[model samples]
Target: MAAKTNPGRFFEDYATGQVIHHAVPRTVKMGERALYHMLYPARHALYSSDQFAQACGLPFSPLDDMVAFHVVFGKTVPDVSLNAVANLGYAEGRWITPVWPGDTLRSVSEVIGTKQNSNGKTGVVWVRTRGLNQHDEVVLEYVRWVMVRKRDAGAEVAATVVPELAQVVPTKDLVIPKGLDFTNYDFTLAGEPHRWGDYEIGETIDHVDGVTVEEAEHMLATRLWQNTSKVHFDTSARPDGSRLIYGGHVISLARALSFNGLANAQMVVGLNAGAHANPCLAGDTVRAWSEVLDKAETAAPGVGAIRLRLVATKGGAPFALRDESGKYLPEVLLDLDYWALMPI
Candidate 1:
């Protein structure tokens, strides 16, 4: 008799240019939005109120951008990172289309590059993943690399292939949702007086809020997205016996905290890069801050794009990201570069 359960794909299983269609298409409903807000302190007006969104030219409130990202990303975990040591980094991420409630989403990944690690016990795999709605329109896409364990340490694999990725998603390439007009955007209702022009390049904002991670919440968040990563769920997966908090958990927490000072930066449109600097565990109080990287004007009426560096730290002085040597500090949990839509 043969084993029926899947052992998951190992390092040697991937090949450059290989296409993998992930399983389980999820139908996102208003319940997901409610649960997401329940899990994190999400307060972006456009996602929180239908009237607010309609006033900005959208039909109604769409799901939060991170909600679409996590659902899509979770669908790929079983195939891409079930045996992964760590999710290395992300680049060239973009939210191509808005995900409304009741939209069914699915994911597909293409292996763009692979490199065998020096230790032979593990290797790195780079893949480009896309999330599509039931209409078959792509809603989100990104490039991410993960270090995965080898099934057989002695097996020889192909030569290393690394794909060249964009350091920044060019502003011109950003897709503003059709009919999104911020001309009538209300600053009072949005909960901030700042507009796009109010922010200057190189400005840093300390969002003074913190959330102590709970084991039950983190586990629930991971399961909500259907992510089956062992490290996030099973303590035995890590030698330290601590269940690792999903990096996306930190990303959402930090984004939610940013609302204190960035309440007007509405929609997340682009993800240039991200790094999970250190593992976050239960009992760690997470804090966040953001730095204005750049600003650009869009063709949309009263619309603008702002590039920001959002950083999450467990416990550290605000604005302190790296050491003199350029390595991430021990307290840093996540460093994310992204672009958002704001009224000009």
Candidate 2:
């Protein structure tokens, strides 16, 4: 039987200096690339057209950076936060490198701080997680806080303190993938010429397209990210012997699918938050829906900021996702909020 774990824990369980090395290693492939395009309708010539990527001096367009982050973070969920009461926030997040198809990924986390809550039922644990590529180079890093349950409600309380963190990463800390030079970026195939000035706030878009994932596809994807969690790959390891799809795969596929309607969104600027509403399994056909949350002018001449809500569902008409509780359906795999850069 698969091991059972309680992700939620009291502050007393953590120490000022602790390290949690997550399990699983994932690998990326062309199937993921094809799915990304079908899902997002991303028209970034580099990601969509091989010729365009070559012109920009890359062997090929690599998988999006967010894809890597999602893969790495998903592996930690069962081990670190399955029982979490709340996710406080993130800090010091950075992408240090690019991830191409065929690359492997893994992750490790360290406890940076801890605090006891006055309520006594829960406490906060601060951890810094680092994602590493197959080459052992750091690809991404972020600090996050979670409210964990106390093993003993009556346990004596210790120190009550919280560590401070930056609200947003500085511009210099944003790592543009190596060899990325927009100098030769194509406006025609890239889908829009409206640099930074053309968007209005509160615009809603419907990205149209659907994809059905197979057990093989998700297993390969999770393995590429170096995420070896058995639930995602080992059917025999579970009571049902059914493999669970990686949440990041669904997120990446949904974001990529968002490209159909949001083709002008060229880069992700901010990530507000995200959730995987239900378990995804092989043989599920996935479709996407999106709504503009807000908009803002950016410093980039041709780029404007568009906040969006992206959702993914299984086997239904567009937007046909909700659960028995009348909430977002259980087949709905994701609900995400983020900011993207679009040409005005």
Candidate 3:
């Protein structure tokens, strides 16, 4: 009899136009918010205090945006990247709705493109994934590509199909959560005095705090999100005897650390593009910096959108992202472009 155990899909298993419904829906709650704060240096007041969230016109404190992202992302690991060599990049992401406490989330992914690497041992798969709440509403969506090993080195896939993706999530498409009014936002309690108008395009801010990633913490975070990828858990997955740190961990760290200067950039509404520039390992001290990219006026009461280039690095000089060749520097761990809501 064939083994009943599930062996995750290999590179050749994916096909363009295929839709996959990931298993295991998760019901997020206050405990997720608590554990998220404990895992990272998250201090955004809108996500930290129900009273503060209510004052800003939300019903109550919603789960941190990354919290919703991680939970939704975790459900897709087994089906998408359990056998992946590396997650390449993200594009065209947007948070369509706020995931409130008690919201049950699930994920659906459609294989949009695929290409066989010249190496013959691996291939790239591009998928557009959407995270939906219990009410069948899409809360988040993004496009990500990953490198996966071929089950058979001699296997041949269909004609290569590469997708043309947007370089950024257009400002007009950025979604502002319902009833989000930041006119009455309190700067003092929010922990920073900087507002939307205070930031100028082309300006950069170096968030001067660093957090060293611990082996235990990364593992805990991986389990918390139920990311069952072998590369992050099994040291033997790679030739070197080291476990890879999850890229989302670095993203949250960078976003949390940005609080030093971007405290009032409270809610993340859109993700333009992102790349895991390097593989992060344990014991690496992660630091962050942000450059103001663009800004737009939103229709929400006293609300505006600010676009920023948030970079996470390991001991790299501030504002240094790529070398002259346009390749990410070795010290650069992440390069993320996203839009956030702030009080004008």
Worst 10 residues of 1 by lDDT: 154-163
- For all candidates in order, the CA lDDT equals 0.97, 0.67, 0.94
Q: After best superposition, candidate 3 residue 236: deviation in angstroms?
A: 0.7
Off by over 4 Å in 2: 1-16, 20-43, 48-63, 70-108, 112-126, 132-138, 143-185, 192-198, 236-241, 315-327
TM-score of 3: 0.99
Cα error of candidate 3 at position 116, Å:
0.5
lDDT of 1 at 300: 98
- Write model 3 residue lDDT over 59-120, tens digit each, in one string: 99889999989998999999999999999999999999999999999999999999999999
lDDT of 1 by residue, 147-229 (tens): 99999999988679999999999999999999999999999999999999999999999999999999999999999999999
Model 1 ranges with Cα > 4 A deviation = none
For all predicted structures, in order, the TM-scores are: 0.99, 0.65, 0.99
Q: List the candidate 3 regions with Cα displacement exceeding 4 Å.
A: none
Candidate achieving higher TM-score, 1 or 2:
1
RMSD of each: 0.6, 6.3, 0.7
How do these models rank on lDDT, best leading? Answer: 1, 3, 2
